[model samples]
Target: MADTDLLKTPLHDLHAELGAKMVPFAGYEMPVQYPMGVKAEHLHTRAKAGLFDVSHMGQVELPDPNAARDLEQLVPGDLQSLEVGQMRYTMFTNENGGILDDLMVFRLERGLMVVVNAACKNLDIKHMSESLTGPVISHDDRALLALQGPSAEFALSALAPEVATLQFLTGKWIDVDGAKCLVTRSGYTGEDGYEISAPADQAEALARKLLAQDDVEAIGLGARDSLRLEAGLCLYGHDIDETTTPVEAALTWSIGKRRREEGGFPGADVIQKQIAEGTSRRRVGILPEGRAPAREGTEIQAPDGTTIGAITSGGFGPSLEAPVAMGYVASEHAAAGSAVNVVVRGKALPARTAKMPFVPNGYKR
Candidate 1:
């Protein structure tokens, strides 16, 4: 889609003023890079702090008194165990154990707040409404921003000192410049960071204030993609989809022990079975030799050229300074250090199965 035809976030003007290269993503016009380029933007965030405008993501509230109990029927995560002000990364599954979408669930005082991919928001909302008795409400009047890096805590603490004391996967309501906001000690970059959600009208002002900090700089989608790749996080349509099972996607950890044993969520039968018997194929990390980068749709082949699986997501890792990717292969080929060949751009590039998180995550515990 063209930028002119896409939805614009509240920070659109700020991005343009910063000389960011705009691109169409998930029905929104977002910045792919600034004048500093993707590589520099990525490294700067790792060393200091990078602010990202992710307001295009969908925020929804489940207002049922039994919101947690109702949500447990959709996802396999143990929502009941989630303490107030804590967050959990989980996925929606279909009847056959396929992943519908991945999301973040925050346990708020009055209700449950969910952050889902923009493209999947409508379907997710519809599904939730039909599946549960809870009242589903989408917050279209909000904007989200992520401040990430080693110095992220310092930058946000200057405005909300309480944010600095938060541990990973926790959240709190705070006052940002006198505006009520939700600040979560969570991020996609695998770094110590905060995700702030504020009223749409106040977004630009809050962004400008954060950017004014010495350690903070505006970042774009290009660097954001690379950072998540290095963190071993899955991008919805890429690494996982309706055809991928949580067990097959190496996301069995997201299934809490209670859900695993009780089997109440959608696809609980198949998912629980896979947990016990193991899956036929599994998502694994692939490290291609040399400088060649494997891309999506690349075929994974055995030594004899037998096709096993396909690449879902792949890109250059700025933190590792090498090319890395994730793909699903047969169980036999999913072991770490196993040799495989990825057919990238018509040539079979030598690749080895490696452990995930190409770079170590520095999230504060």
Candidate 2:
């Protein structure tokens, strides 16, 4: 869709004023990059702090008193065990065990605050409304933003001093520049950061405050994708989707141990079976030998030229200064150091399965 017809976030005008190159993404007109270009923005994010406008994503409130228990039935997380002000990364599974969508569930004092992907927000809410007999309210009046990197706390604390004490994966309602905001010490860039859910009207002002810091710069989606890729974070609809199971996607770590044994959520039986036994294939990091960056849909083959899988996410790692990729391959070939071939064009390119997080993660755990 064209930018004219796409939805605009609260910072849309601000992005334009910053000379951002707008692009249509997930039904929203979002910034892809600024005049500084993608490479510089990406490197700056690793060294300092980068501010991102993530308002296009959905913020929903599950207001039912039994929100935790009710939510447990939909996702494979131990939501009932979550302490107030805690957040979890989990996914909604289908009856057949495929991922419906990956979401962040935050336990709040009044109810649960959930963030879903922009593209899947509507469907996720619909799924929840039909699955659980609770009130699902979408907070369209809110805007989301992220400040990430080693200096994230320094940048955010200048405005909200209390934010400096927040631990990873924790949240609280606090005053940010006189505006009530839901602030969480979490981010998608594998850095020590905070995600702020602020009132729509105050979002732009809050963003400008953060950017005013000497360590912070406005980042766009282009650098966002590269940073997350280097961190081995999955991009919904690409790395994971309705056809991919959590086990196959190597996301078993996010599945709570209690949920593993209880077997209550969707596709529990199949997932449990896969957990005990094993799946035929598994997701693994691919290190392409040459400078040529392999892209998504590139074919994977064994040493003997037998086809095994295809690349789901692939790109050059700016942090590593080399080409890195990830794909699902046969279980036997999924181990690190196992040799594989990535067919970029017609030729089979030499590559190997390697440990993920192409760069070291900087999450302040």
lDDT of 1 at 61: 92
lDDT of 2 by residue, 249-292 (tens): 99999898999999899999999999999999998999999798
| CA lDDT, candidate 2, residue 357 | 86
Native-referenced Cα lDDT, model 1: 0.92
* Pairs with steric clashes in candidate 1: none
Ten-residue segment with the worst summed lDDT in candidate 2? Answer: 356-365
Q: Provide the lDDT at 92 for model 2.
A: 96
Write model 1 residue lDDT over 221-304, tens digit each, in one string.
Answer: 999999998888899999999999999999999988889999898899999999999998999999999898898989999878
Q: In order, what is each prediction's RMSD in angstroms?
A: 1.1, 0.8
> How does each model score on TM-score?
0.98, 0.99
> All models: lDDT?
0.92, 0.92
